[model samples]
Target: MPNLPDPLPWPEAVAPDTTAFARQAILNLNRTIFGFELFDRSLAQGTHTSASDAALLFNVLSHAECEVLMQRKIIFINCTHDTLASGHLELVPPERVVLELPPLDAPQRDDVETHLMALTDIRRRGFRLAFDQSVLTEPHLSWRPLASFIKIDISHASESELSAWVQMARQNPKARLIAEKVETEAQFAMAQDLGFTLFQGYWFAKPILLSGKTVRPAQAAIIQLINLVRQQASTAQIEDVLKRDPTLSFNLLRFINSAGFGLKHEITSFRHAVMMLGLKKLFRWAALLLTTSQGAGTSPAVANLAVVRGRLMELLAADSLTPEECDNAFVVGVFSMLDTLLGMPLAQAIEAIALPDTVVDALLHKQGLLAPYLELTVACENADDAMFAKASATLKLSSQQVNWAHLQALSWTETLVD
Candidate 1:
């Protein structure tokens, strides 16, 4: 590694677990984002241990936000051999994932065969495979045919060594070359000259850490309310649940009166919110609340951000979408932070409730009419001019309109906080 300057220290108040994930973009020759390699940011090597691999997969698949992430672009995940055989592997859509496996350490011939057997099963399951330079070594040669991507660490490889590996991988026809660890212009130029089509490392962009504290909800009250709402129970019974938990009641009223709901007046009572939203939307609101409920001492910043996203997307779509689609857009925006809010495996939270297919598509699949609005809201929040321009263009909205809605949403969130 070239001697890069040291990065600023992590904030003292930020817990290690808040360093939940780090995703480094993988770029194609044209320098577009092809996929991301996700890492456990807390890990020293940024690689997953067996347990963490399963946990990461669980988090990725279950979180509504992560679903949107996977739907748009492919992701490369580092895996231990044990993770290859994990049932969690079966849960992911094979086409959207590429499992990067390390080669055996000082493998015996039989050890190669054992690993190959696992790889074959996984490959048959439809996941593509990526390997380090060790795949070019003779012992691992039998495993070569299954490779869809071969990554060469350009930082370590001599020009002649890189040339040899590139030539060998080219012979396979199916295996594309990735120049990993390309931290400088010279390394990138060298790899490009050698015909590497995919590149990773600090040259294009460093890994971006996504952090969030897990939300732990007091579920009994919320679950009962959801059940009651699901059964189309009378408003009295539903109100009973809210009355039992003052915090839930407070949160419900706060959310209902928020600008995104478009209420003509404040909904100070639980029964009023139910009557206004009707059963369908009321249920979604409650289900969403299940995840948003945070324990004491936990910051409300994430939930507040979620509401801002919800309202921003709603305002952006108000001119373009129907009432129902606008509401779905709000759900997509709020639930976009589902993984961080729920704190548990996403599967657990999502499986317990039902969402409209359109909301599901926008939240989980990043597809449907509302998805672009959600994307625009995020772009606006991040102040990403390029993405903001692209998403606004896709939706055919002017920048002035989006900026106005964004400022309005932030201002509205302040009211909720106060």
Candidate 2:
């Protein structure tokens, strides 16, 4: 992979939005597992967005906060070889920060040893170290003495790999084992069975609408009504559809009367609100429902993930695409995983709704320009280097653009969800 450029000049203001970061942390962990460790990016000065700088900021800030909360537990933060060489550890109080060494590309033994030795010094000063995304088998274990924790990416681990991790965890009683990407109940169970204590992933809280199942039938009805309204059907025709679904009609009237529509007069019936809202506003609301309903039951984390992905993708394509095209890309990113979130198939979930041509194409077929962006988003979520590289190349996007998009997406998701 190509090296990403130094932090492109920070905008006039770094939006004081930490919500996306918090949300990603929550979604990544699924349930509220105490001691939330996050990658802090606020310290990157000027034009350089150094991974090392991010790691150091996380260690300093999160560690202090965790200690203040009376949690003596270690908060995991990623550190690169460059940051380690900079003696960033000297600035951080070691007892609380768990400096997680990210997987290096070349797998150099000498470099690894040198980094481990530096970590050992930090550990002796009361800091803990961990190996993140453990991919190298027994060879990586040589640095175990310097690590207080080991994070295994159980998502890609095979039976033998899992067994190896379990054996290693059991043998090293002093080190706590963490299982990353524990997305499903099965994964969680396996991690627990394997003696891993820390866990992360989206299984605990699914992305859902605020109303959840209560809104499903209404949502389906609303989509149908919107489709009819968009067709320029007569008021009576729309009314006829509304009359058939009294509950939906009643809810529509209620929604219109509520603060959402700032109407002084109480809308007594669905037809009245429909007429008052007009076709354009009605269509807009209906489209908003697709997003609102989808976000209902999701934890702050899951909601943030979708939001960031959508916004980042939109931002990336803003300069190249038309407004409509950009909007389609955003929709694709937001609705990409609706099936997994709703516990329904994607086709089934989007069946009744009418989306844009590009949105529909990307969602249903994963083809078109937006599809590659969506794929890149998923690849980032999985941290699949090969897939990420492939998607970036296919999209003709630079590595720097990819990283910026990922970070911005994560940040945006956190804010929107919150």
Candidate 3:
């Protein structure tokens, strides 16, 4: 057996249940999530150790039910200067991931050189690299040529200082500069003016509400399908509604044929899909369709939040609610954010669908058998320790159960993307 070093101290961040992982989007200039930077929300409050980062990657990739991440977006992971030499990251395919190595605190070429062999090995194996703008200075400069991306904090420098930093970064023409903390349109533009095409921040996720806004016609068609599925309408009746929009029908076929369904053969038509999947399956698919139908303008972060909420709520209710009630709990979580997703108020957005009284009540008023589950799920997302303690006790659940369920929910949501 190999000897190991003493355990590294955990960062001061509030401890999360061992099962939970938090993911945030890394967006590009066009306001789309180019990648997800995942970390231990449980460990987020405190400074992170490279050990934690390695563990996060292992947890995210080990789950087989979901692809480790979105197909099109790369996943950026934090790496310690030391972890680079630990050989812990060899299990992950470098093409799909980037190691965000922090700049050397000071130029100790001996210290930096110790890991250079491993660093160059990972880069040779296809792993890209990201670092702060500081890497362009000092002994770290020796490490700069290996960088594929450099992130400059918009808030970290004064306007004049920022211009200098951007100017300095130009020396590394091979590296793409990323502007982080770009929260508003003006800053985003400033970053672009300075020549940054990649960005990270929440500017795009803010709700774009407008007065007198109602559901779009496309959204209306989706709502109608939800109602039909709820009523257990015949296939022909459901097909009539589906035929109204080729897009809705096309999305349905795509989902049915998705890896989630694991169909051995392709489903070519609506009727064939219906017969193969049955009405119960169709109803579940329709519910998912309605929840996810708001696209293009919708931020993936918002949609991802809704899915996590729905999955968490359903998981929390599993032990206490009937099978039918569990389904409603899931629906409540998924639709809880529909008002935000649709850009219409909750009352009006939900009014278009024929959801069960319990699901509708929980989403609208937060009162029903399922409402407690919704509140608990929100508490988990926010990491409200007091609320989590109270809700878990009131529901007669243990920390272990909640942790297990929360982790499972996150894993399940990851699978929903593809």
Candidate 4:
């Protein structure tokens, strides 16, 4: 073969990873999520750089948690003039994300018109624009017509000031109003009354545990199947349980037939699927049912996190544990977030499903063979350097191994969630 040119070399160290700590400001209107505003959460006390914004986009859209957290929803991202020109915006799909730009100083006054011209070019390329309420004031007035959304900080604005802003927003019917830092019922109601289209801040995410809602039959049936798999029940025995729930059986067959399984032929019977998938995969599917099966008030956020943790823990357990123990590790990871999903205590939520004593101990008290795996998985998520070091040392794992597993889990979630 003829000599070929070498590919471009990879960077020495990964970028600072600012996106790992970014939290989503999930915006809502009338109980439905409108979009997510990803804010950088650097523990360091200083101003953010252009790199921070770039890292945020990469995490949300490129390689991090975007696919799961941003499923079919609009995303609001903070963009300074520096970030806008950094060329990272071109990497994302403009249709799904709204670029929230901050106010730029009109140093030469002509720069204002110049900046708008640049923004107009971006808008032509399919990206929508968002501006703060300050854009309603003097120098930004010329920029206001270009805004698709206007964010008002309700925390500091006076009553009359909010009224004026609201009036200004009404004048621009094309602009959607968003109220941020809304903390209480009064603020939420006031924002609603004032015609703000989207609301954000503490009040929106206040967890309301669902104690009144009963578990759906299909969900309960899935739980039964998971327990049966754990008990090492025969395929015939499990088939009888699935027979009672046609909906659950149909879902299993459909899932096996879907692209997720990569099967050559569609599975028409539960037994055939069990035999095709075998026990290991059958249990894996059962475990996924907890996350994917629709029910009342199950938080996709919790489900997605659980899936990542479960897969990471299972990967870490490779070569060190039995096949069955590895399966338990997966169970511990995915079900660990049950408390957040069910809106109850972990004990109560886990009680609804039957799991091994080892898995239960890991979930309940963090004391078992699988407990360290769960702890390490969580430490990975929180970026706790000390815990990660300690957990890896205890498990005889290296940072490189954990990082590789973490990336693999994120990739799997991207395919599974969307």
Better of 2 and 3 by TM-score: 3
Q: What is the lDDT of residue 20 in candidate 2?
A: 17
Worst 10-residue lDDT window for candidate 3 reads 1-10
Candidate 4: 10-residue stretch with minimal lDDT: 1-10
Candidate 2 Cα errors over 4 Å, as ranges:
1-83, 89-97, 102-117, 124-127, 132-148, 155-176, 181-185, 193-195, 200-215, 218-300, 384-406
Residue-level lDDT tens digits of model 3 in 214-251: 67777788788778878888889888877888888887
Ranking by TM-score: 3, 4, 2, 1
Instruction: Write model 4 residue lDDT over 41-117, tens digit each, in one string.
Output: 44244356677777667756764434755678788877777776778777788998888888866564557777887
Indicate the residue-level lDDT of 315 in model 3.
76
Distance from true location, Cα of 74 in model 2, Å: 9.4
lDDT of each: 0.69, 0.59, 0.72, 0.71
- Model 3 scores a TM of 0.69
> Any runs in candidate 4 off by more than 4 Å, and if so which?
1-47, 51-75, 85-97, 102-126, 132-143, 152-168, 178-208, 259-266, 297-329, 339-345, 356-411
Q: Candidates sorted by lDDT, descending order?
A: 3, 4, 1, 2
Reference-based TM-score, model 1: 0.46
Q: Compared with the true structure, what per-residue lDDT tens digits does model 1 show for residues 1-418?
A: 0111222232343333332344566778766667778765334444457778766666565654456444567888888988887677767778878999988776456698888999999999899999987887878998899999999999987989899989888877899999998876679889999999998876443211223533344565776777777688999888888888888888778777776666577888788867877887676566556535644422355566677688778788887788878777777787676555554444444445556788777766788888889777766544355666688889997654554455456445444423
* 1 against 4, candidate with superior lDDT: 4
Predict model 3's lDDT versus the native: 0.72
